[model samples]
Target: MQSQPHVPGFTIRLADAEGGQEQEGAPKATRGFRRRRRNRHGRGLRGELMLPNLPGFRSRSERFDDMVLDSAERLQDMWGKQLDGVLFAVDEIPPNLEQLVAEGTAAPMGSCTPGGRGEAPMVTVYRRVVEQTATGREELQDLVHDVVVEYTAEMLGVPPETLDPVYRRRYQ
Candidate 1:
């Protein structure tokens, strides 16, 4: 039982019959020529668990953005030049939500801000609120489209039904 030199942060193990010293319970050293992969627990090389084209690959916020863009494109096809300078956006929640709740007003699902001082008209939907209000994916898509249409209509000074023929059709 020959004693080994003490190292500050590592435990030294005695040389085995192969005549190479190793750290206690440590993996054997590999040759530099051996390629290392990011495999874990003998699983294959690390990569996306789901394909990029899969629905699960996209985040909720990204999917929400897509819904907004889809609705915007549909509206753009209809309104074209009128929607040219309008901006569509999404926020996690409405600002001053606590104040609105304290004042007995529900947090807004969306808002329409009229353009002024060279700023473009903006429509914003509160993502969390709208998502919570919807029960399923199809419902969420419809709700998001309706919210965008509603705000766009407000900005254009027209009723939502007049702006989009399909507005509120789900409820009817």
Candidate 2:
């Protein structure tokens, strides 16, 4: 390396022969490399995700929408009628529900049982439990589906296949 005589009190800048930040002798593809692409839903697609609403879960995607459906839809599809609208406990869930909530807080799932005569069945769904259990929307959806199907069937005292299969077909 040749050391040019230093000019006193002068700041010197060196420019790379190649473009900025490229490794030495790196092959240059076209300057017009693709940046990225976003669909109407604002979700980015690299190759083959097949997801519709990329940025947000809700949108025109059938899969995403199905994931968001309430447990009522599961019962309605299975039994051919919507079970009374889904109700969750505003108060804290019982100990039994805590275990289930540990499974998923975002999609916490549970059911209410009858307190006594004139008291409605308390199909309790623990939101905190579900949230704690879930990692993301997809996981939450799956957790909700599994918990709802299992809990509802248990409350009705029927085999899962007896009710679950019917609704699974309808929703699918």
Candidate 3:
């Protein structure tokens, strides 16, 4: 019989059909068996190696950041030069209780800071609040886009409908 390939800390043994051992070396079979056994119970060496390659592996905060950036890019396409001085940002959540109390709300989805004296205006989207408010993936995308549009419109001193003709279409 052909011998099995050698692995670290493993030895292969071949046996006759009668279940008698033909050759034995260092209990090598146990190494492979150990690996299989570990994986069967939970994540093991194999899972560690493959985890980084799996789709949708980014953390929740990272995914939220991606959504914010993507929403900004789409708005940039629509606004062009008008968006040149706007700085887009994402925070896990808004700052302390002061701001929440000031707004008279339990959650604030986004905020805008008008720049002064050579500084660019900044728009901050609250990741955790927006994410928690969304019911699903498509809703999340729409909500993020809405927040961006609203903040940009406020920065430009225009209404959201003026910024995008199709802003918030329900049936379309």
lDDT tens per residue, model 1, 1-172: 1111332222212112222337699997774222455454676556667787887877798788778877887787677667776677778888899999899988899888888897667788889999999999999999999999999999999999888998988876
- Kindly give the stretch of ten consecutive residues in candidate 3 with the minimal lDDT sum: 10-19
In candidate 3, the residue pairs with backbone N, CA or C atoms under 3 Å apart (3 or more residues apart, or in different chains) clash, namely: 11-28
Give candidate 1's root-mean-square deviation (CA, Å).
22.6
Alpha carbon deviation, residue 95, candidate 3 (Å): 1.9
Per-residue lDDT tens digits of candidate 3, residues 1-172? 1111332222222112222334656453455442364666666555444365676555676676667667666666666667765677776667785777787978778888888886667788888788889899889888888898898788889999888777788327
- Candidate 2: where is the Cα deviation over 4 Å? 1-69, 81-111, 166-172
How does each model score on TM-score? 0.71, 0.42, 0.64
Which pairs clash inside model 1? Answer: none
Q: What is candidate 1's TM-score against the reference? A: 0.71
Ranking, TM-score, top scorer first:
1, 3, 2
Number of the predicted model whose TM-score against the real structure is largest: 1
> Residue 38 in candidate 1 has what lDDT?
45
Error of 1 at 83 (Å): 0.6
lDDT winner, 1 or 2: 1
Candidate that scores best on lDDT: 1
